[model samples]
Target: MYIFRLAFIEAQLTDAFIQFKNHYGFEVQVCNPRKGNEKGSVENKVGYIRYNFFTTSPVMNSYEDFTETLRVQLEKDRQRLHYEKEVLIEDLWNEEKKYLLELPVEDYPVFKEIEAKVNKYNEAKLDNTLIHIPKASNYPFIYFIVTWDKYKAVSPDGEILFEDFRPYMNKKRAIPWISIFKDWIRKPRAVSYSRYKKYLPGRINEYLLVEDLVVRKERLIEIVNLLVTHDIKRINEDFYDLITGNNENPFGLDWNEYDALAPTGGEQS
Candidate 1:
């Protein structure tokens, strides 16, 4: 009875957060911002974790890679003896495992609902970024199910029309070259006029600016295709290697297949 009284102490919580706790059948003691010391063990462990895990300044390729590395590190950390219990931390967890409840049978739904207007570009503006929605001209507005990492466009009948990764993920400061490449490839001459042209290496930009229209178009197509998988530096090195006789075809393409992409400079007689 005394334990129950202590567990039910009033604390601030959002409706969704409360729902999350209920779904997992777990108790969460809410800690106010200034009173974070109420969870002193957790707070201290954060500092300990930073000193141990981040002191080396680890680099990760992506968000998923970081999570996987952290999971492995955490499991390894669990093998150590508990500071006060004088037993393996894993053993302590094993001893308490039986008291833990199983996770809920159904997955918890997590998303923020927001109404998005279908724009003239057949895309919806989400978080002030545009995401293409197929056949969006048929509808004036869409309701997006927004999560931290992705968004989903749902129809009036709940049919999913589009699903896309958020623009900001892993690209907070990087240019979205892949997003613009498709449209730009169709108009090769417009490469110099593109906003992203300035982001390209000066040499590549200069090469594309040469007076020979057909040569510029061929080079632009090669760059756009190679850019899909390789970075600008690699593209530059490969192009230079090819021109220097070190590589037979650094673009890895059969020019015969791209005949139409580069016309015969003038109409065939």
Candidate 2:
């Protein structure tokens, strides 16, 4: 049977139509406008149908779906109406059907596929942008598949994350300690001395200058790193041994007392 189709030129429907023509070997007519009267017949029929049927339909949902349903209903109208030639519309359709084109088995316009990962923060990491998933609790993880254009991110459960693309790596997590130390070093001695005065013991306050604050902070960082890597018990024992000057008795003295009293536990009591 003859089938009529309408689509926008920007949509590139011509290629699809041509593929149908090549496969079916039928007499295909493309109703595209070059200048005038190109779409006049289509436009007039569209308006007439809309005004006659669509305006009267009480249960129409969407304009597009309503128009499609109207087209099908018009076929029934054509069958009932008597033409000047006394030929039925269904009879006309039967004659036209023989010369109509057939569609291909294979679907056209292949789509591109891309890979993406979800990070610990539950944000979809696509390319560079971190996309936040709405109602994220429904999904098992933060990962998503991004379309080729990176316009959309589909979560594990097929929920779409709209136009939110950003850098994949987390800058805050990777803060440069060297740069931070350099900035601290450039600050005024008085500012540093005032900031760390609480860490120094009452007697050691007079001995610690601004330079000592930097040294103490660096040592604390090292000690903390070791404590985290090894064990708290080992660190406390080592600190006590360093402070008490008795290598054999590891936990002989208080760790906090050593931290407060001595700049470096090497200083003699």
Candidate 3:
């Protein structure tokens, strides 16, 4: 029997888990409530993971790095001899893997697809985050396939519009500012009213909020250029640092009078 813990969700089994079970033709046996003894081996494995792998907090730089660390840890654990068999766990896994069913040709759909309307701002909200929909000026709506770490926006005709990495697991909102560059350039003043304007560096906001429209336009152009020329992920971290007072400008710029007050179309001295 394929034993599993009782889930608190209405379906008890997750949609993905159910799909996997159906594909493999497995009969699930859920343990009785509060009966830890029935799932003693699973509980023991959990305890082992908690004590051995999670005893201390890890420095997780990124999801990929954290997953790599976990994979390495599992490999290290498998190097040990099995408790009952007195053989290396890795060798046992080699035999066990051979008996497992071959994976299907097509991968199971683990992501949820949702239809969303592009708002007047040419953006679509997914999981509370605003994702930019390029060429959405005419397209009224798009479909977003949401996964654990990323999501893809597809047109009605199955053509991919755009895709972006989910910022985090939590419900915080984010903007893919780069994707909306053209719109922002057309309406540079709208940056003041953007949802993510609060995330901008104070120095940047101050520079862009100047009374001079020319200076503001120049600053907006510069901001777009900085985002376009550099790694967006690094720029995002720099923005965080600027927010926390750890850095001055996300772009590492010390804007002088020439940069801030320069004429729109004149040559630099």
Supply the global lDDT for candidate 2: 0.46
Per-residue lDDT tens digits of candidate 3, residues 11-59? 3888779888888776798876778899999889989988988878987
Per-residue CA lDDT of model 2 for 1-269, tens digit only, reads: 99989766652457757765566666655555575477687888788777877675457554457668867888777775444667887887788889776666764443344445544333444555444444443455534443332345455665664443233322222212222223334442442434233433332332223256665455444443543443433444454443334365433323454344433221111
Pairwise TM-score winner, candidates 1 and 2: 1
Q: What are the lDDT scores of the predictions, listed in order? A: 0.67, 0.46, 0.68
Model 1 agreement with the true structure over 165-249: per-residue lDDT tens digits: 6766644333445444444555666666765566665445555675666766676666667777776655554545533345666
- Return the clash pairs for model 1, or none: none
Candidate closest to the true structure, highest TM-score: 3
RMSD of each: 11.0, 20.0, 11.3
Per-prediction TM-score, please?
0.56, 0.30, 0.57
Which prediction has more favorable TM-score, 2 or 3? 3
In candidate 2, position 36 carries an lDDT of: 43
Which portions of model 1 show Cα errors greater than 4 Å?
1-13, 31-33, 156-158, 168-257, 260-269
